[model samples]
Target: MGSGFSVLLPVYDGDSPEFLERSFDSVTVDQTRPPSEVVIVQDGPVRPELTRMLARLVDRSDVPVVLVEIPVNGGLARALDLGLERCSHEIVARQDADDISVPERFAVQVPIVEGGADVVGSAIEEFVVEGDGGLVRVPPVGHEEIERYARFRSPFNHPSVVYRRSAVRAVGGYEELPLMEDYWLFARMIHAGAWAENVVEPLVLYRVGAGAYARRGGTRLLQSEVELQRRMWRAGMTSFWSFSRNVAVRGVYRVTPEPVRRRAYRAAVRRDAEREAHTDQHTDQPGTTDAGQD
Candidate 1:
């Protein structure tokens, strides 16, 4: 693959100007490799702020900004595929309108993309606003370990990923799976024996509820999990026993004692916070306006 790269940002109604501004801030660009293009796909009717943000970004950045507006909302996969087709570079990065990338995210990941991994993602930290001058922290985990633990849980947070345009296209880009498009893509990638690796660094600050996770109800989330199990089984990456174990663990989480469950959730969140802080030490400030390069 060549050194140049592009970013595909799929925007929707609720995306705010502040979020987009912050997203641009996190990418660390250098002269060696700068983002050649940023394709922002508006899947449906856009909010006033979102429109204003797009205008501002197109005007301010040196990189080319291509805005594609679709009359009807077809879903994320379709919007992403539309962006993918328009990309001109060899390396493509994914960003959600609401999720914020860490500074140096692309600068760090692009080199790995050349190392032959079809998909290169990283550990992630997440945050939820708390009352009165406070934010909650989420921790980072190892992807290899997470895959090993996937028999009982979903360990990879897909938003914090950067993949090769060719490898993803090889898997047919994004499929019409249940809800988690990233997970579905991962299943197919692993099944095809595509080389995918994860950097230990936490390169993205994924906003949970307001971003990707809130699009569905609880029933849909459960169904999506079940669907992933079936896909993995069919792909031969996971055995029936592993699928059953994952489902059983999720069921146990549902019926566990309140205090114990609360503690577990809190502990998990605290760990994420610690991991974010640690990764931040190696990264630049989160609010700078330098786009990433390949």
Candidate 2:
């Protein structure tokens, strides 16, 4: 409701305590402009270790955290829907349990979203299983490029995204799309004539591993892609050609050998030397030491 935004973070059993702390700190306390509040959704029953970690984080964090645990494992889309409904702010930022955000992530995005953008996301620094792994930067900046890029791939990083509360609600919140919930929501938002933009800089450290890749590269994904593209084509957000392109390209990636897929994945994202270089210049950068993160 105020100038500050609400961060929506959802987690499950597999998330580590290290990831939970860094992700929570990056959004709640370790930023130039911290959030007004945080709405963390427990998708379902998590491991006991994760429960203890959540308790420790909520107990230690200065920001107000509202925990909403569902009765059972409702999956990400339903969890996010509940979180979005509980948010009191007009602007909502998305934070993944295992990723880290730049200290200035909110400071940079709030102004642009306040200006006129319905959805504003930044490029991300993609790392592998280990936090210190190599980085990869994605392309397309500004609303125009984002719209263009959406035809082939997800233009904005999901964890690095912030959306106008009303804009997302008007589109019926997030849907239970197999592996493309974020991208599916983006397309629906665009089809509804929402204005979207992508900041050229990296704002979040995106974590990926075999698990993340496996989610996106299963045979089940073909059906997901088909359904998503059908919705896109029916909504007029994607053309027949674009629909075919998405299925073809994404299908190949899913069917490719694991090693080749990993290579391709690495090729799609870029090194975060830029974010690291800027860290030395900025005094307020977040120092997420590996200490106690485990």
Candidate 3:
């Protein structure tokens, strides 16, 4: 049977009430199949205005909203762990306070998860504060491709995902990790025999700007990349060379000039867009089923 749906949202003081309201609306009002309940985890203290906003959002929403608070700032992974345990459904759809999930996302992904898929995610359209930007797409589509992609980059977009709680719990509940908690969890799941699929379609609008670029790179992210890749190496997920190479490339990308890094990222996105367009041109051509975690 198809598992029930619940949203897992982790918020912090940094998440604005404006974004939170939009996020809540996207899941509860915009969605074709709003989650049975929305489990929001307050990672730490929030502003008084945010507190008022949350209270009002819950008061007006039809779907139940369960809010949990961490006494202190524990970060995304820990907050997610809290939300996961409180989730009343077997299928948990992840959403970020700053992202807007497409209305049909749950409708499209539910069947895939019901058909034995453990994890499912889709591409995203990135937006600035005004909601206009490029598409942010994950590179892999199936389990085989996903694992290989993992040796390099995260195989799925974290916010555009729905995962089976049992499959995730079987591997291990969310554990705090440096910058890449989602990637780490997926790697462990793949290691534990769980399967995943990427829908190859954009299902969320991700918010980002210059600040995101700055946050994504630099010395701190370099350290996290190195630490994460090394963990994969220890787990036998990658060779020493792959580990070293990933660290070097990512570190360089991080420390590179922002303009150059931006161009490179944009170029890659352009290429992906072109390739997808070309594939779509051949309407009858056989291609990946966009099915099977493989």
Report the number of clashing residue pairs per model. Answer: 4, 7, 0
Runs with alpha carbons beyond 4 Å of true place in candidate 1: 28-33, 128-155, 208-217, 251-294
lDDT of 2 by residue, 29-54 (tens): 78998998999999889888899999
| Candidate topping TM-score | 3
lDDT sort, best first: 3, 2, 1
How do the predictions measure up, each by TM-score?
0.77, 0.87, 0.92
Better of 1 and 3 by TM-score: 3
lDDT by candidate, in order shown: 0.68, 0.81, 0.83
lDDT of 1 by residue, 239-269 (tens): 8898788767764554555566556666765
Off by more than 4 A, model 3: 129-133, 275-294
Clashing pairs in 2: 1-89, 18-293, 135-270, 136-269, 136-270, 137-269, 137-270
Residue 50 CA error for candidate 1 (Å)?
Answer: 1.7
lDDT of 3 by residue, 1-294 (tens): 345689999889989899899988999889887789999999889989999988998899999999998889988888998899999989899999988988898888878888888999987888886455566664566677677677788878889889999988996787777678898898889888888887877888898855876777777777777788889999998999998898888878888998888887878777765755554554335774432233
**Candidate 3 residue pairs in backbone clash:** none
What alpha-carbon RMSD in Å does predicted model 1 have with respect to the real structure? 7.7
